[model samples]
Target: MNYMDEHILSLKNKLNYDVASNNVNTSLSQTVISEQDHSVSEKNLALRLGDELIPLELRVILDGEIEVSVPKSFSLMPLEQAKFKYPSEHRPEVIYTSEDGTVNITFNRTESTLANEELPEFVEQMADVLRSVQPIRNWLGTQVIVNHSGLSIGLIRFIAAGVDKNLYNEILLFTHAGQVMMGTFNCMESDMEAWLPVAENTVHSLHAVSLPLQSSLEKGADSL
Candidate 1:
């Protein structure tokens, strides 16, 4: 079978297993899940990414400390969600991709806060990393301030072109609550203009909510 069909089958098997284990009588339908019926906790902050009624999937990590909302048009994979590597630890929180596979978005969080002044150096390091993997055609990086969900956020926008003629764009942001978010969008050089804005808006829609330590502990206990 093709990859898409295999992916859909895998998702169905997972959902069926979850339902059977949970003893929930809900019927399993299509692989794509609706936003309203997502399984994430209600305590998590809501993030709206444009008005598109695209099918979405939700992923929670770090004992509900981090949440990610991804469109079903893209494939989703859960990651370890840890900064430092330990045995059996996954690095990224989640990953998404567009239907064509040329576009990709990765969502990750670090425990430490990222300072605005340090972004340029970080981008430089990233640029070096990208060059090591692929030949670079051009690179640009800039910082911007964004207001979303009543929070003033420091954002870094990085754009580059690889010798393969693919365009890459990434948005890095840090929250006052000491959470770092990174979203990378990639597409063909010719399609960059049309897809860049959509990627940027998706990044902008990311929202962080802070819960008291006691509340977090209580929630974790309840889940167990």
Candidate 2:
């Protein structure tokens, strides 16, 4: 089966979502993680999220990991990882399905930086489970949290909103390396809004997001 088909199946089995083959299609990985330790030139490519064309730069590490970095200005949305060949030692990309159906894809390459031929059976199963959610709509918003360590490190938690005409933008959180926590979406109109309900001070090294007055109205309008 193709990557899209396999991913759908995996999602159905894992998340209990009855996704059909026609409902899901394989798309490119939104974020690519390359390792700087490797001896490969940087590759520049364009990434499409909904309708936006994002400029992507990938640096391949000697061991087999791909270093990924996106522009600070553009909002990062959830994406599906496509099939590609790389060194074998590299850990296959991963996807997480939240209780509310938010999909998070993680390309774990802390180990070696090699891309193996085709994805292993295990990784394929994980992808299927991850994409089972109904795609995010223009008016909807989702809170995303990312954890990273090692040579490259960062923790990002932000509210992603398809604010205008499917144009998504992300409010910055404590987007730094090491351990970090932050919150962004606090409005009532979001499609599936939830928060990390812990003490604010305990978020010692946390990123805090402000709910501007204008943003409140925008969110309200999007919901309508």
Candidate 3:
């Protein structure tokens, strides 16, 4: 249930694909999704954060199969800058960066094959890996896997050391097209208080396309 191999090359190619063709209308959550509003509870709470709302845009990604909302001011990271900013040998499938490049949201769908029901287990495994990867990292919090819009989402947050400063990172994992899909939000630790709420709102706004399972579900329903 690991996230499997990095398909960076193919992912980069996919980044060039015209996502605009698959665009859909959507809106981000107006208020922060309450911390207690997760799989453990059926009722989701929306708490108002006094921070000014950031404009958001809804767009499709991962070959136009996933629909989600991100800050409208963010732009796709240019290939050269992605290499420089990330500089890591491994990188996400695609990255959207703030105008100054300090804040970022990333998306990556790995080659790992999986079924919908197995998502929570895999996510737990992934969480274990995250802990192992940075043994001394400051742990923020992790969420119980949640069912949203027919998709299973696992969220984890931590503070990772950046080149010259600390960063607040939140990662959301799910499955699509039989693969594990990852979405992330990160910013300087100084901005965490303001952006973390927005990140939570963004999580609520995401709606993964479930077409791949439709045919099978329909067949089973017919048989029933």
Candidate 4:
């Protein structure tokens, strides 16, 4: 069943009415959730190019639907790099933002009432949103790159490759600008593409492990 309409509407409702008031208003709802009939897998991979230890979590949202909440540090990059304007002709939602430095990203089908014949387009739009965050997979190597461009979004990219179909086919990353920001992947795929803040620490971290020297050999080996 296609719950696109219902899903989108429900999401809007949740955002409009579900806020706690106490001097601090924190929106409450199920943000960052995957659709049914899908599996999500996350892993921590070391980068081969940097000295920093990066935590990359891979989540595959199958049957494809994902909702993500954003961190306060992320935001739209302004007119030159990021556009915060809502889609007049075609735009994504600006789910959440706070003056106290809080942001949430949300994505789903448009609530403009999908025509009976618009299912294909609707699904494609949803897929495009999901595809925007897919990971770049390097089969022959042990590294991938991500570029996340959302508003004040302190994004943490995930890298997951070589998994059974039952595990994942799509990934999701969260930022403050919702769909306004852009992300890029570094690997190649015939049927796949990548998304989000270029992973700078994974491969570089894996290469930093050093091996101890032998008593006789007096040599040390390092991980790369």
Highest TM-score among the candidates is held by which one?
A: 3
lDDT of 1 by residue, 91-201 (tens): 344546555344556555544444545444444444344444433455554555453443344443333434434454554444445444454444555655555544544
Question: Per-residue CA lDDT of candidate 3, range 53-87, in tens?
Answer: 44556767878788776666678989887666555
Candidate 2 residues 33-145, lDDT tens each?
A: 22332211222333334566444333222133233332222233334422221122232333222222222222331211212222233233333333334243332232223
TM-score of 1: 0.50
Score every model by TM-score: 0.50, 0.20, 0.67, 0.22
Candidate 4, residues 1-224: lDDT per residue as tens digits? 47564544433332222111011222221112221212112233322123443333432121223322222233432432213323132323333222232222323232344333433443344333333433323212211222221112112222233222211121122222122122222221221221112222211111111233463255333331
Candidate 1 lDDT (Cα, 0 to 1): 0.43
**Clashing pairs counted in every model:** 1, 21, 0, 30
Q: Score candidate 2 by lDDT.
A: 0.27
Please give the lDDT score at residue 175 for candidate 3.
72
Ranking by TM-score: 3, 1, 4, 2
Clashes of 4: 30
Cα lDDT, model 2, residue 121: 37
